[model samples]
Target: MHPSIPGTTPDTSSTTARSHPKHLKRFIIGSVAVLSITGLVAGGAFAVQSAADSRERVAATRALTDSTGLQRDQLGAYAGIAEAHTDKTASSTLAEANQVLASTEGKADASALTAVSSSLASFESMPIDLVVELTIETQTETAALSAAAAEADRVAAEAAAEAAAAAEAARQATLATTNTPAGAKAFAQSLASSNYGWGSDQFSCLNQLWQKESNWNYQAYNSSGATGIPQALPGSKMASAGNDWATNAATQVTWGLGYIKESRYGTPCAAWAHSQANNWY
Candidate 1:
């Protein structure tokens, strides 16, 4: 049982009631589209962030690998030097670095890789410094050994030179004691008897022959360029007997006796007879 109102339409109530479901449906659809777009945007941002992180990780890992390779090469070089020099400290340091590098293998995180790379770089310097120290020590020892060897050689040379000088001095002292005129004549007499089988008569003739020529003086020099007890025409001729011909009476007597024995006379007595006739013999 309804009653009529004024002229405000009853159709308005029905139309308004019907439009609410349409408006509500449109609002629901618009809200669903906005939520879908927001989700897509959020998902895209997450994917972009994930890809960037992967690139960073890859870059870091590559850097770590390259650095590790360089470190390994350096480590190998240092190990060789250490082994050659027998440096225990440097070898130990390299071993520790090797363990650290081994620990970093297969790591993939960016932060972890960068950290390990830094640690490795720092570790490399320690072994290098140790190797340098070892090299310096080895060089120092080598130089010291060389210096000691040179000193030893110098001392040995001086000792040898001193010994030679002492021997020469002893020879000169002996010559001074036994090279007088009387000593020269006695030596000649003994040599003539023993070597030439000449008797006292031969020695007496040899003595007279030499006395006339140079008076048995070992240092005798003649104006005819003759010298020594033998009075050879050239003083250098006496070098056949001994290097000390100018000063040694025994050398001069030996040469003179040989000349008398081997000459055309072949005997001291014959040589004396010839000298007595001529001024020179």
Candidate 2:
């Protein structure tokens, strides 16, 4: 109203100035409340994040501890297996190998054992496989030696049997010549018939001839150094027939017959005729 402009109103300057102070105070209080609420929310968020991080750390530590325990258990299992292997080898194979070695000839006798003591004393230090191989080789050698010994014995037995048979043959060969005069004639008669295709007449002639000389005594000897039933001159000459020619009548008779045949007196009758004429044949 006091000189107002065309479209302007009058100002309440004093009233506005009085209300502005109250408004500015309220605004300042509200801003402080909002800032306190915001601070409380941020603090709660930080606490929750910290708790989650701590739980994550705890889970990671547990996982690492479990992994370490599993690794330790595996190592223990490997160690136990190695220990079992050592025990088994020591108890069974090693013991058996030692026992076998102890039974060997080189270790059996006290005197023989000393020769191999150095090796045997430290034999356990050798590897188990090597010990086992050596044991097998030794056993095989022992078996071979036993077989050789047995074979030698068998051969010796066979030779002894052959020698015995030869001796028996020599004894039987002289059986007829060792008989008494009457028995000699009977045996000669049988031999003449079977071997010489002669009859009793040839044996009778031979008996008479030998009776005049030695009476068929296998051990007959003469002052002229003659020996045996055939009275071979130079008694040692009968050795050509047999080493026992002096005692073996058949050996002497066989030699005498061979001599007669070579001298063209092929039969006992022929030898007797020649002997009768010359008193010796």
Q: What is the lDDT of residue 62 in candidate 2?
A: 46
Compose the digit string of candidate 2's lDDT tens values, residues 1-281: 22333332333132232233432221111111101110112212321223333344345434543755534335335444543554354445334444544554332323322323333334345443444344444444444444554666688799999999999888676564355555555555565677667777776777777888887786788888887777788878878878877665656776665665567888778889888899888
Error of 1 at 179 (Å): 3.5
Q: What residue runs in model 2 are displaced by over 4 Å at the alpha carbon?
A: 1-131, 134-137, 140-179
Q: What residue pairs clash in candidate 1, if any at all?
A: none
**Global CA lDDT computed for model 2:** 0.53
Model 1 lDDT tens row, 21-134: 332221111111111110122212321223333344345434544755634335335445544454454345444434433553333223332343344333333434434454
Steric clash count of candidate 1: 0
> Among all windows of ten consecutive residues in candidate 2, which has the lowest summed lDDT?
30-39
Q: Which of the numbered candidates is closest to the native, going by highest lDDT?
A: 1
Q: Tell me how far the alpha carbon of residue 97 in candidate 1 is from the true structure, in angstroms, after superposition.
A: 33
Candidate 2, clashing residue pairs? 174-250
